[model samples]
Target: MKAFLLVGFGGLAGSMCRYATSLLFTRAQSDFAWGTWIANVLGCLLIGLIYGLSEKFQWLTPEWRLFLTTGFCGGYTTFSAFAFENLKLLESGNYWTFSIYSVTSFAIGLLAVAAGVFLTKM
Candidate 1:
Protein backbone atom coordinates (compact mmCIF):
# COMPACT_ATOMS: atom_id res chain seq x y z
CA MET A 1 0.00 0.00 0.00
CA LYS A 2 2.70 2.42 0.98
CA ALA A 3 4.76 1.36 -1.99
CA PHE A 4 1.77 1.77 -4.24
CA LEU A 5 1.36 5.37 -3.24
CA LEU A 6 5.06 6.03 -3.64
CA VAL A 7 5.10 4.53 -7.11
CA GLY A 8 1.85 6.26 -8.05
CA PHE A 9 3.22 9.61 -7.00
CA GLY A 10 6.55 8.96 -8.66
CA GLY A 11 4.80 7.92 -11.85
CA LEU A 12 2.72 11.04 -11.87
CA ALA A 13 5.85 13.05 -11.42
CA GLY A 14 7.80 11.06 -13.98
CA SER A 15 5.04 11.40 -16.59
CA MET A 16 4.79 15.12 -16.09
CA CYS A 17 8.54 15.39 -16.28
CA ARG A 18 8.58 13.33 -19.46
CA TYR A 19 6.14 15.68 -21.11
CA ALA A 20 7.98 18.74 -19.98
CA THR A 21 11.29 17.36 -21.09
CA SER A 22 9.86 16.46 -24.46
CA LEU A 23 8.41 19.88 -24.93
CA LEU A 24 11.71 21.46 -24.06
CA PHE A 25 13.59 19.15 -26.39
CA THR A 26 11.12 19.40 -29.23
CA ARG A 27 11.74 23.09 -29.28
CA ALA A 28 15.49 22.56 -29.66
CA GLN A 29 16.28 19.00 -30.72
CA SER A 30 13.63 18.14 -33.37
CA ASP A 31 15.32 14.95 -34.46
CA PHE A 32 13.29 11.86 -33.57
CA ALA A 33 11.59 10.16 -30.63
CA TRP A 34 13.37 12.12 -27.95
CA GLY A 35 10.50 11.87 -25.51
CA THR A 36 9.68 8.19 -25.58
CA TRP A 37 13.32 7.15 -25.63
CA ILE A 38 14.24 9.49 -22.85
CA ALA A 39 11.42 8.35 -20.61
CA ASN A 40 12.18 4.70 -21.24
CA VAL A 41 15.90 5.08 -20.59
CA LEU A 42 15.44 7.23 -17.54
CA GLY A 43 12.90 4.82 -16.11
CA CYS A 44 15.18 1.88 -16.81
CA LEU A 45 18.12 3.52 -15.09
CA LEU A 46 16.00 4.46 -12.13
CA ILE A 47 14.64 0.97 -11.73
CA GLY A 48 18.12 -0.47 -11.99
CA LEU A 49 19.38 1.96 -9.40
CA ILE A 50 16.51 1.15 -7.11
CA TYR A 51 17.09 -2.56 -7.35
CA GLY A 52 20.81 -2.23 -6.95
CA LEU A 53 20.46 0.01 -3.93
CA SER A 54 17.85 -2.24 -2.39
CA GLU A 55 20.06 -5.25 -2.78
CA LYS A 56 23.08 -3.44 -1.44
CA PHE A 57 21.35 -1.84 1.50
CA GLN A 58 18.53 -4.24 2.13
CA TRP A 59 16.12 -1.35 2.17
CA LEU A 60 13.55 -2.80 -0.12
CA THR A 61 10.41 -4.42 1.15
CA PRO A 62 7.52 -6.01 -0.69
CA GLU A 63 5.63 -2.75 -0.59
CA TRP A 64 8.66 -0.82 -1.76
CA ARG A 65 9.18 -3.15 -4.66
CA LEU A 66 5.54 -2.90 -5.57
CA PHE A 67 5.69 0.85 -5.45
CA LEU A 68 9.02 1.40 -7.18
CA THR A 69 9.25 -1.61 -9.46
CA THR A 70 5.62 -2.27 -10.37
CA GLY A 71 4.19 1.19 -9.98
CA PHE A 72 6.72 3.85 -10.96
CA CYS A 73 8.71 1.76 -13.44
CA GLY A 74 5.50 0.41 -14.89
CA GLY A 75 4.04 3.85 -15.40
CA TYR A 76 7.24 4.94 -17.07
CA THR A 77 7.78 1.83 -19.21
CA THR A 78 5.85 -1.14 -20.44
CA PHE A 79 8.40 -2.18 -23.05
CA SER A 80 11.42 -2.18 -20.76
CA ALA A 81 9.44 -4.04 -18.15
CA PHE A 82 8.58 -6.73 -20.65
CA ALA A 83 12.21 -7.05 -21.71
CA PHE A 84 13.43 -7.23 -18.13
CA GLU A 85 10.88 -9.82 -17.16
CA ASN A 86 11.69 -12.00 -20.13
CA LEU A 87 15.40 -11.68 -19.54
CA LYS A 88 15.03 -12.68 -15.90
CA LEU A 89 12.84 -15.63 -16.83
CA LEU A 90 15.38 -16.88 -19.34
CA GLU A 91 18.23 -16.29 -16.95
CA SER A 92 16.49 -18.40 -14.34
CA GLY A 93 16.15 -21.23 -16.88
CA ASN A 94 12.50 -20.64 -17.71
CA TYR A 95 13.21 -20.92 -21.39
CA TRP A 96 9.70 -21.87 -22.44
CA THR A 97 8.05 -18.92 -20.73
CA PHE A 98 10.79 -16.59 -21.93
CA SER A 99 10.37 -17.72 -25.50
CA ILE A 100 6.61 -17.26 -25.39
CA TYR A 101 6.81 -13.88 -23.74
CA SER A 102 9.54 -12.63 -26.05
CA VAL A 103 7.66 -13.61 -29.19
CA THR A 104 4.38 -12.19 -27.97
CA SER A 105 5.86 -8.92 -26.85
CA PHE A 106 7.81 -8.35 -30.02
CA ALA A 107 4.86 -9.27 -32.23
CA ILE A 108 2.37 -7.20 -30.27
CA GLY A 109 4.64 -4.22 -30.00
CA LEU A 110 5.32 -4.23 -33.71
CA LEU A 111 1.69 -4.73 -34.66
CA ALA A 112 0.48 -2.15 -32.24
CA VAL A 113 2.90 0.44 -33.59
CA ALA A 114 1.88 -0.35 -37.13
CA ALA A 115 -1.78 -0.13 -36.28
CA GLY A 116 -1.29 3.15 -34.46
CA VAL A 117 0.57 4.65 -37.39
CA PHE A 118 -2.03 3.43 -39.85
CA LEU A 119 -4.85 4.77 -37.74
CA THR A 120 -3.16 8.11 -37.34
CA LYS A 121 -3.09 8.51 -41.10
CA MET A 122 -6.84 8.08 -41.30
Candidate 2:
Protein backbone atom coordinates (compact mmCIF):
# COMPACT_ATOMS: atom_id res chain seq x y z
CA MET A 1 0.00 0.00 0.00
CA LYS A 2 2.75 2.41 0.94
CA ALA A 3 4.74 1.55 -2.14
CA PHE A 4 1.69 2.09 -4.31
CA LEU A 5 1.06 5.48 -2.80
CA LEU A 6 4.68 6.48 -3.20
CA VAL A 7 4.70 5.45 -6.81
CA GLY A 8 1.34 7.02 -7.55
CA PHE A 9 2.20 10.36 -6.04
CA GLY A 10 5.66 10.31 -7.48
CA GLY A 11 4.26 9.44 -10.87
CA LEU A 12 1.84 12.33 -10.69
CA ALA A 13 4.65 14.71 -9.92
CA GLY A 14 6.86 13.27 -12.59
CA SER A 15 4.09 13.50 -15.17
CA MET A 16 3.53 17.13 -14.31
CA CYS A 17 7.21 17.81 -14.72
CA ARG A 18 7.24 16.05 -18.06
CA TYR A 19 4.33 18.15 -19.27
CA ALA A 20 5.99 21.38 -18.17
CA THR A 21 9.32 20.49 -19.73
CA SER A 22 7.74 19.44 -22.99
CA LEU A 23 5.77 22.67 -23.13
CA LEU A 24 9.03 24.58 -23.06
CA PHE A 25 10.09 23.04 -26.36
CA THR A 26 6.74 23.20 -28.13
CA ARG A 27 6.55 25.36 -31.24
CA ALA A 28 3.38 25.86 -33.23
CA GLN A 29 5.10 25.89 -36.61
CA SER A 30 7.53 23.03 -36.01
CA ASP A 31 6.67 19.61 -37.39
CA PHE A 32 9.35 17.77 -35.44
CA ALA A 33 8.50 16.04 -32.21
CA TRP A 34 11.21 17.87 -30.32
CA GLY A 35 9.26 17.92 -27.08
CA THR A 36 8.98 14.16 -26.92
CA TRP A 37 12.55 13.67 -28.10
CA ILE A 38 13.91 16.04 -25.47
CA ALA A 39 11.78 14.50 -22.74
CA ASN A 40 12.97 10.98 -23.53
CA VAL A 41 16.62 12.03 -23.62
CA LEU A 42 16.35 13.98 -20.39
CA GLY A 43 14.50 11.19 -18.65
CA CYS A 44 17.16 8.69 -19.71
CA LEU A 45 19.95 10.89 -18.43
CA LEU A 46 18.19 11.49 -15.13
CA ILE A 47 17.42 7.81 -14.61
CA GLY A 48 21.05 6.90 -15.30
CA LEU A 49 22.31 9.58 -12.93
CA ILE A 50 19.95 8.56 -10.16
CA TYR A 51 20.70 4.89 -10.61
CA GLY A 52 24.44 5.51 -10.57
CA LEU A 53 24.18 7.64 -7.48
CA SER A 54 22.08 5.09 -5.67
CA GLU A 55 24.61 2.38 -6.53
CA LYS A 56 27.52 4.46 -5.29
CA PHE A 57 25.82 5.86 -2.19
CA GLN A 58 24.66 3.64 0.65
CA TRP A 59 22.31 6.27 1.99
CA LEU A 60 19.75 5.88 -0.76
CA THR A 61 16.82 3.73 0.34
CA PRO A 62 14.55 1.32 -1.49
CA GLU A 63 11.55 3.62 -1.09
CA TRP A 64 13.52 6.45 -2.63
CA ARG A 65 14.50 4.18 -5.46
CA LEU A 66 10.90 3.22 -6.13
CA PHE A 67 9.78 6.84 -6.05
CA LEU A 68 12.53 8.14 -8.29
CA THR A 69 13.05 5.38 -10.81
CA THR A 70 9.96 3.22 -10.99
CA GLY A 71 7.56 6.04 -10.29
CA PHE A 72 9.06 9.29 -11.50
CA CYS A 73 11.11 8.03 -14.40
CA GLY A 74 8.39 5.61 -15.36
CA GLY A 75 5.83 8.40 -15.58
CA TYR A 76 8.22 10.81 -17.25
CA THR A 77 9.06 8.54 -20.18
CA THR A 78 9.06 4.77 -20.23
CA PHE A 79 11.75 5.00 -22.88
CA SER A 80 14.17 5.88 -20.10
CA ALA A 81 13.38 2.68 -18.28
CA PHE A 82 13.82 0.75 -21.49
CA ALA A 83 17.14 2.50 -22.10
CA PHE A 84 18.28 1.76 -18.56
CA GLU A 85 17.38 -1.91 -18.83
CA ASN A 86 19.13 -2.18 -22.18
CA LEU A 87 22.23 -0.55 -20.73
CA LYS A 88 22.24 -3.05 -17.88
CA LEU A 89 21.83 -5.92 -20.30
CA LEU A 90 24.73 -4.65 -22.40
CA GLU A 91 26.89 -4.11 -19.35
CA SER A 92 26.26 -7.67 -18.22
CA GLY A 93 27.18 -8.94 -21.70
CA ASN A 94 23.72 -10.23 -22.52
CA TYR A 95 24.13 -9.16 -26.12
CA TRP A 96 21.49 -11.47 -27.55
CA THR A 97 18.79 -10.40 -25.15
CA PHE A 98 19.77 -6.74 -25.54
CA SER A 99 19.56 -7.00 -29.30
CA ILE A 100 16.16 -8.66 -29.13
CA TYR A 101 14.84 -6.11 -26.67
CA SER A 102 16.11 -3.16 -28.68
CA VAL A 103 14.77 -4.37 -31.98
CA THR A 104 11.42 -5.52 -30.64
CA SER A 105 10.85 -2.37 -28.65
CA PHE A 106 11.33 -0.15 -31.68
CA ALA A 107 9.39 -2.31 -34.06
CA ILE A 108 6.50 -2.97 -31.71
CA GLY A 109 6.24 0.60 -30.58
CA LEU A 110 6.03 1.94 -34.10
CA LEU A 111 3.59 -0.72 -35.10
CA ALA A 112 1.42 -0.01 -32.10
CA VAL A 113 1.35 3.69 -32.86
CA ALA A 114 0.51 3.07 -36.48
CA ALA A 115 -2.27 0.72 -35.52
CA GLY A 116 -3.71 3.25 -33.11
CA VAL A 117 -3.58 5.97 -35.74
CA PHE A 118 -5.23 3.78 -38.32
CA LEU A 119 -7.97 2.82 -35.91
CA THR A 120 -8.55 6.42 -34.98
CA LYS A 121 -8.80 7.45 -38.59
CA MET A 122 -11.43 4.82 -39.23
Clash totals, every prediction: 0, 0
Model 1, 5-114: lDDT tens per residue? 78788677666766775675554546688777777777778777887799899998877776777777777776557766876797799999888888987899899999
TM-score versus the correct structure, for each prediction = 0.72, 0.94
CA lDDT of each prediction against the hidden true structure: 0.76, 0.92
The superposed Cα distance between candidate 1 and the true structure at residue 5, in angstroms, equals 4.1
For 48-98, candidate 2 gives per-residue lDDT tens digits of 999999899855699999999989998998889999999999999999999
Could you list the CA RMSD of all candidates, in the order they appear? Answer: 3.0, 1.0
Candidate with top lDDT is 2
- Candidate 1 lDDT for residue 40: 74
Name the weakest run of 10 consecutive residues (lDDT summed) in model 2: 51-60
Per-residue lDDT for 65 in model 1?
Answer: 76
Runs of candidate 1 with Cα error greater than 4 angstroms are 1-7, 27-31, 116-122
